[model samples]
Target chain A: MTVFTLINISLLAILVATALTVSRLRALYEAAMLSALFSLVTACLFVLLDAVDVAFTEAAVGVGISTVLLLGGLALTRSREAVTPRRRRLPGAAVAILAGGTLVYASQDLPAFGSADSPVQRHPLTDTYLHQSQEDIGIPNTVTSVLASYRGLDTLGELLVVFTAGVAVLALLGPLAHPVDARRRDDLDLVDYRVLRVISAMLMPFILLFALYVLFHGDFGPGGGFQAGVIFAAGFVLYGLVFGLDKAQQVVPRVVLWALIPFGLLLYLGVGVVNMLLGGSFLDYDTLSSDPAAGQHLGILLVESAIGITVAAVMTTVFFSFANRRATR
Target chain B: MIGTHYVYWLLFALMMIGLYVVISHGNLLKKLIGLTLFQVGVFLFFISIGKVDGGSAPIVSDDVETYSHPLPQVLILTAIVVGVATLAVGLGLAVRIFETYGTVEEEDVLERDTTP
Candidate 1:
């Protein structure tokens, strides 16, 4: 077999193995770790499939932030999953198998994998985005152009969704409403690990710097607002995991996050409003500058920064809400 | 030809396994794990469909003539973020359920609720 085929087979095997192990493991911690491993493997698969951008995101958000959030949730409850009754397994299995069988059979009709003439590759939008984006949006990354310029409205909606999720978690947890209780401050500190503390302190600046790089360099590379924001939040999460939630909050207080989150969304909306007022359609960055290319660059930068701010704040807010709730319990 | 298409079968199997786990598990966290796996299965399937047999990554460059479809990558990127968001919300609810019921198991929570 060719090397590419071999690599694909091995990665697929690892993914399946990880999934099986996660399902069978009773310990939630082990399962969480395995799930992170699964994400890592999936990221590699994305890489193998020539999707480096997705791989970058899968690695950062999937493996890093989500794993931390899962662990945070696990902290608030028991580590061991209760034994499911055996009788409960049959119907779900049958239904799942039925669905699986239908899909597998249907796959026979799918165009051969990676065929050049596949419908997706042949689509007009694909050609437009791939060829015309350079002239219209003036960005090297077509994904960035398509995401920010072509589908700006969808992305704006997604930002609002992330904002809503942050709000919903805050409502559920009710931690942000109350300040960090001074009396319970001692209960949350984990100062014992001098090594972790020192390392996180050393790495925090670089992580934040890297987040900035990802945010700004998105037009030229795989990094973007979503990935940058997650990385930024992850830096704080690491700090929180090592030091304390209250300490991390001091670095980014709830009030600031609450204000900044909405502000970021407003910034995005404001950009579109300006575009409309400038005699262009909403989110039409072509009118933002004397030259349309320069306008695209400026508009994408501004909007991406907005997204970055909102996403970072939302993620950090959600993390704090969960972490604080765990502490109080 | 069948060998070339084995990827779909394996991915489908994984999807079913994930769905079965979600359905059969009593623990809310296990359900979440299964849900994530299911999502990943979809992601893999989408990414697989975008690949060109001898294509390179879709970054605009001088040397690469054929590249994988960028649309799926863009779609999947958003989907991944949304998946994590949904997972976060679900986990938050799970935590609340655990707090109220004193257990993460669905049947146990149900039993506790009906009794009260």
Candidate 2:
């Protein structure tokens, strides 16, 4: 066996261990931490599977943002899970086993792992995307080209889903209210840690800069608006965690977030409308510039920037909303 | 054959474990965690299917002769972000439910509603 296969098996073993442990934990806080670990391991597995972009995203969203969100949710609710009665557990187990058995029975026909003869590998569309994207979109990253240009409509839909989630959360939780007194709270911010404060302050600019780097570097590398936006929001989340939500709010006011939340999606839609006006179908980037490649590049850059803006804004808004509630309470 | 298929079986095990957690857990937060686990399992399964034995990542490089399928990665990439969005909404609802019901336990909320 190759070294990569060995590593893959080991990581999968670790994932299984973590998942089992997480399922058994009744302490919600420990469970949250373990879930973060699960994400980290899964990100490693993604790397082994040659999905670098996915690995980057899972690390950022699953480990960083999801953990913080889970912790924030824990702060608002109980930290311990209530014991499920033994009588109630049996049916769930039975159902899960039956479902899994059916899946396993069906999976017997699946192609062997990593076989080049698999239907996914042999599909004509895969060949076209891998080769034609170079000539058609002029990007080194097929994933970015496919996501931004070829399947652009799907991405727009995904962005709308994210925007809708932000709006839904806002409606459910209310807007992030400014803390009445920013300076009065002891428990809200980590006021006593001078070392953490100094480090976080130093790291803030680099974090935002790196986020921008990831945003622009996506054409040739394993990043794009989604990962960049999450990293960008994570920087603010770190700031809020250490300094205070009040301070973070000052850095990015709710008014700005409210505007930004929809602006990104509108910008994306506006681009499609422009495409239609320019005598192309919706989201057809070929007509944006004299050269088709240049048009694709410009269109992708604009669309990715829009995605980055909306994702960052929505993430920050959600974090602020959760933190604001705790502060006010 | 069993050796080649072990990964699928393992993934199925992981997925089933998640399903079991989601079904059996009473706490709203635990259920969300289970849902995430299930989502990640599915994501892994997709990525696994896209893998090519001797291929590198999908980034266009002159030196790499073969590349893994980029389509599944693109699909899962969107799914991951959408998954987090769904989680955020779910958490928001959980918090809201806790606020109204004064507990996040499913049985307690049901009992309170039925008793009243």
Candidate 3:
């Protein structure tokens, strides 16, 4: 048997087991944990598929950060449901038939399992990045080049989405309405998490460093602003969990955070304006420098920085809003 | 030896199981887990479709070199991040629901929904 055949069998077994466990498991917490395990396995599959950057993200966000957040949310609430399933098996059967038919229809046109030549490989966009990117952008990693350079504008919008969500959380949640005033308490106290506080404190610097490395390293890899920003904010969140939200606020500063929203937004707009002044289209970095390649790199770097700032600030602000509600109440 | 079609069958089976749990189960966390399972099953399906039976790993090692479908993997990575973000937001909503309802059970939470 081939290696893929063997791998497929194991994967099939795992997916089945995880599904059954999720269905049979009664407790919400157990189910969430099981789901996280599934995500981790799926991430491993991604790595095996040569998607290492994605694998790192899936493991970090899906298995680690998101799971912890879900559990923490669960802790504030009760565990498990009181009701059992009463739905019949036929609706599912009918749905399955429909979905199956749809899948078959779609698969008919799809290239057989990994036909060496497919639209994905031959697509103009990927072709440009794969062949033209090295000379045009001076980046080793085509994915990063595409994400930060070719699609810089899209990344800017994504940053805005994150920033807006952060603001919406704080504005609607009402707990962090006046973060500055409430950040003055005995912020040194770690509450029930003194040990955790110490660990997170030790880890925070490294986490931030990793974020920077990812940001600067994107020229050759999948590390970029959006991912780096999320990771950086996550590190701060770990700190908040350990040292308490109030303490986190003091260090981050309500002024700095609230200001960062506009700052990140303006920084992005500024890049666009710079492009306009330099005689390129809005956000076109090639105009900023005499050499288009240098301009592209600088543009990507600046746009990436903007993305990182917004993601970090937004995620931290949103989490603070969640934890601060009861504390302030 | 099993044929390649059987591999597709297994993928279909896994997908069905996950979808069933998600739609049939009433437990909130169970639903989330099922949703995640359902999503991952789909990813597996796509990744499986991207695999070449005799092709080597996509990595460009000195000893052996081959090309494989790398796009799907990257797309799946994005999906995974989107999945986690959705889960975080969903859990946040669940927390809010619990705070107002004092329970995580679907039926109980629903009944108490109007109470708040």
Candidate 4:
């Protein structure tokens, strides 16, 4: 067997084992950790498949922030899952089996794995994005070009969805505030372990710095705004977990997060508006500057920065809401 | 020759396992885990489909002659972010459900609903 096949087999085995373990485990904490493991393995798989950007985001958001957020949610609720009765399980299993079977059957018609001559590779859109984009966008990263410029509207819609989710959480959980419970203050301080405190304090600055790197590096590499934003929030999340929630809040206060949430979305929308005023289509960056390539560069940078800001604020907002609920409860 | 499709088959199995967990488990948290598994499995499947026989990473470099399609990678990249956002919202709702009903089990919450 080739080395690639060996790596794939091992990673798949690990993924399967982790999934099964997570499914059977009743303890919420263990399950959450296992899910994080699942994400890490998936990220590795993405790397093997030559999708470095997806791998980076998956590692940062899926493995890192999402796991932390799950734990935060668990803090407000029970850690152990109630036992599901055996008889009630069949229907769901049957449906899943049926769906899996159908998908596999459909896959029979697909071209073999990793064929360079596959229909997807021969598609005109792929050819255009691969070759024309370099000259048009003047960015090394074709994915960013396609994402931020070619499919600008879809990205706008995605940003709005994330914004809406943030708004919904704020509505549901109310504002971020300190824990009302005197007992909770003591509970929060438990994370004030001297070792964790000192280590995290040392790490938070570097993490934030790395986040900035990811945000700006999108033009040339796998790093981008979404991954950077999550990393930024994750730094604060680590701070919150280590110190007390109140201390973390003092650092990033609820008011600032709230304001920043909409500010980022508006910034993105503003870019489009400017384009319209400049005699171009909405989000068409060509009119933004004298040189079309330069315009594309500037538009992508602004839009990506906007994405970073909104995503960071929203994720931090959701975490605070969850933590706030737990404390107040 | 057909055995080469093992990767896809394995991914399908994982997806089914995730689906089964979401469907069969009564606990809300377990259900969320299942949903996540299902989603990740789909991600793997997409990435697998995009792989070329000997293509390098899609990043533009003069050294590489063949590259996998960048479009699917971009699509999946956005989907990953959306997936996490959706998971956050779902978890928030789950927390609220626990707060109101004092349990994260679906059956327990259903039994407590006596508005009729």
* Residues B1-116, model 1: lDDT tens digits: 56668788889888988999999998998899899999999999999999998898777877778888888888888778778887889989998888777888899888887995
The local lDDT score (0 to 100) that residue A125 gets in candidate 1 is 83
Kindly give the stretch of ten consecutive residues in candidate 2 chain A with the minimal lDDT sum: A176-185
Best candidate, lDDT-wise?
Answer: 2
- Itemize residue pairs with steric clashes in candidate 2: none
Residue-wise lDDT of candidate 4 within A1-329, one digit each (tens)? 88888898899999988898998899989999989989989999999999999999999888778898788778878889877787877898789889989988998888888888788988898878878898899898888888889988888888898899888877766543223421235565647489988888898889999999999999899877788888998898888878988899899988899999999999999999999999999999989899999999999999999999999999998887777664325
lDDT agreement with native, every candidate:
0.86, 0.91, 0.66, 0.86
Write candidate 1's Cα lDDT for A184-250 as tens digits: 3444577997887888889889999999999999999888888888889888888887788767888
- Native-contact fraction for each model? 0.67, 0.82, 0.36, 0.71
Q: Is the docking of candidate 1 incorrect, acceptable, medium or high quality?
A: medium
Candidate 1, B-chain TM: 0.95
Model 4 CAPRI quality: medium
Model 4 chain A poorest ten-residue lDDT run: A175-184
A1-329: candidate 3 lDDT, tens digit per residue: 66865775686678577767767777878877887787787777665655566666667666656666666555556566555645545676678667766765556666655455667655676456555776788776655666666766765665565565566566654354454534333433467676776777788899989989988987766677667877887888777777777678878986788778678778988999988987789877788788999988888888878877876776676666556544211
Q: What is the lDDT of residue A95 in candidate 3?
A: 80
| Tens-digit lDDT string for candidate 2 (A29-114) | 99999999999999999999999999999999998899998998898899998888998799889989999999999998999998
For candidate 2, give the lDDT: 0.91
Q: Rank the candidates by TM-score, best first.
A: 2, 1, 4, 3
| lDDT (Cα, tens digit) per residue for candidate 4, span B1-116 | 45568889889989999999998999887888899999999988888888887787788888888888888888888888888888888888887788789888898889899655
